[model samples]
Target chain A: MNYNWNWGVLFEEQYLNWLISGFGWTISVALSAWCIAIVIGSLVGVGKTVPNKIVRGICATYVEIFRNVPLLVQMFIWYFAVPEMLPEDWGRWMKRDLPNPEFVTAVVALGLYTASRIAEQVRAGIETVPPGLSAAATAHGLSTAQTYRYVLLPISFRIIVPPLTSEFLTVFKNSSLALTIGLLELTAQSQQIAEYTFQGFEAFTAATVIYVCIALVATILMQVLEKYTRIPGYVGKEA
Target chain B: MTDFDFNVIWSSLPFLWQGLQLSLLLTLLSIIGGIVLGTLLALARLSGIAPLAIVAATYVNLIRSVPLILVIFWFYFLVPLALGRPIGGFYSALIAFVLFEAAYYSEIMRAGIQSVKRGQVHAGQSTGLSYWQIQRYVVLPQAFRNMVPILVTQGIILFQDTSLVFVVSLRDFMTASSIVARTEGRLVEMYLFAALVYFVICFSGSMLVRSLKSRMAT
Candidate 1:
């Protein structure tokens, strides 16, 4: 209440550049991790629903193991423990020679951790598709993969657009955790600004606003996509 | 170096156990606080009052947009200045968790409330119930029942998130483990043990929630 307030310091060149690059890193990490999550999550999700008991069990176990662990702990494992677990030279390479090891580890950690949650959503979306569609596809002589590619996936992806958007936002938010591993992304940059300037309120408030803007834009874009991709006479109409 | 050590964990259990207690305490207090605040937020959003609805929606979206660690830092830094005195890390972290979790809990509660049929409210009103009475007697009971599983799931998330307090140097379970890991040079052992405890607790908690969900379905 008594302290001097200086919001204008954020506009000064030094901190502005830090925040800009920090925002860029946040987006890059989040978007790349999202790509990994969706790819791996869909495969695991399909595996979960497949008739092969062994494959299903493996997928289920993967989801369980990843989902049960905290993302922070998982990041530490990837950054610290996993590198040392490798052979001596490989460990050294990971610890030293790897390009932006913190960034890579963060992407892997956030991606794999989120993939479990995405897998669940993907599984739910796929299962929500009518069974008769798959049955009809098979009757028409289409293979299982073809059925998923043509019939089930098209509909389920449409149905799941809204949830996927939420997950997308989640990935963005979770990117802030990458700071823990020494990636100076948006949240970390904000903290650094606060540390140096003693303007914690201004720094975090700006970061919070940037985060909200990103989430809002993502939400709006996804809503538009959801509107267009919605299956007529189906899910989106009712709810 | 080749051998895994369980002895360090056993030796350090007392210190780690205290941290675990703190984690649980944070989770429990925040659960109660979050649910109460969240219910109000849910009702406010649903109340159709322009200002209240907008405020509730904005609060939920804003909090949900940022990483919770930032919120923890915000409160850690701001609360003391706002109050003209510094507070302890535990209290700061607890306040952050409560406010942050309330945003998520509000969204869940909103969905739960919306899931209750509109006719239920009409029925309550037809029976001479006041507005508050209708909500208390008719809407809330059903919404609470519907939301129990999700609330517990969020509670598990809150437990996991408590680890972020390591940034504030709070001696939560993860912090304690990291401390022991550093001092004792048993990095792998300490971290893995900490992870295992978290995994066991969260895994079992989710299983319980899954069963509760199925039971509700049936």
Candidate 2:
């Protein structure tokens, strides 16, 4: 094992800039996708629990279709086929005029994919809340909507904060798949550095460290959130 | 837009099947390897030996925190040089997946092991069973049975993740489909077909898991 070791190459201005911007993109994409997942997933999740069988069926179907497919394939469909499926002018606009198409496609693909998973979590969280609470709220003359808004969601959200943390970390890790569509996030940037410097070992090692750092910080922050929000008597049970 | 061509895909089935075989091979190999190593790590974490527990915990945490694709790259590039020899992409990716999945499997198995009744171990100890005997005869059988559904779920995830090996230019199903798509200029057809194949397999696999779960519940 006589290969040259050049750990210092990562600090070069060119590689450093790539890593920084890539890191920025990765964080931005993951954060934006997390927002989308939580918002849509919550709605779809609540929809799944509604009494109307049709709404529940539709929401379940959405989760199945999105969750069953591979993220890479979904990304490909979004980046390539989706644009072509639109009307000609809109399709052309998307392909030619849309700003940061790869980033947009990546975010949309990752968001919708993750939303299905989060929807399951959200559904589990909602279902985990005691039935008597909603019953009591109804008995107090609160409408179903108000009961959920004031009573059910608050508690369920607290219960789900831990699993949501895992999903949050997952969104960040899955962002690395965006490189398949040419968004130069951290993984892609590392690959580019490796290609230029022929130092795949160091480049990937650095990227791995960065990912571990970011994920650990997110985990710690989520742990703190979980600890503070944890209902003393209700912790540690699986939903 | 061009008419969708069924003929190209039909004619390419043999090549596609070869790719599928490789994908399955990777999945099967890695699942076995991961479970074997994962059980060891899980045991180490539960072994009540501080250094072993700390080392296992760190390894699992470090592996779990990073994107698996990065691990594939690290193994693909680093291991060969460390061994003072070059290895092929497929072998490197296989090793990478095994090592990466072990962390996740360990976590699942750890939870499963903990779920077993503590009294059962006490009972075995009272019968004069050695510690290793208690684990082997009393704890692990129950734990593994409890974890089968979860292990299957993880296996499904492993199948989906094997697509990531396309990054290494492995001739897995995804890479093969993309190759055909590029050469034949049937990008949409190829990709959509590929997605459908994945969806059908995974969706049915999950359905089976759901039924198995219900059976377990009953």
Report the number of the highest-DockQ candidate.
Answer: 2
What DockQ, between 0 and 1, does each candidate earn? Answer: 0.70, 0.72
How does each model score on TM-score? 0.97, 0.96
Candidate 1: clashing pairs of residues: none
Report the lDDT tens digits of candidate 2 across residue range B1-218: 54678788998999999999999999999999999899999999999999999999999999988887778878888789788887788889999999999999999999999999999999999999998899899999999989998999999999999999988889999999999988998888888999989989999989989888999999
lDDT of 1 by residue, A1-239 (tens): 87778999899999999999999999999999998999999999889998899999999999998988889999888887887677778988998899999899999999999999899998999999989889999999998889989998888888888889899999999998899889999999999999999988899999999998999898998889988998888984566
Cα misplacement distance, residue B16 of candidate 1 (Å): 0.9
Residue B100 lDDT, candidate 2, scale 0-100: 96
Flag regions of model 2 displaced more than 4 Å.
A236-239
What TM-score between 0 and 1 does chain B of candidate 1 receive? Answer: 0.97
Instruction: Tell me how far the alpha carbon of residue B52 in candidate 2 is from the true structure, in angstroms, after superposition.
Output: 0.5
Candidate 1 lDDT tens digits, B146-213 = 99999999999999999999888899999999999889878788878888999999999999999999
Error of 2 at A169 (Å): 0.6
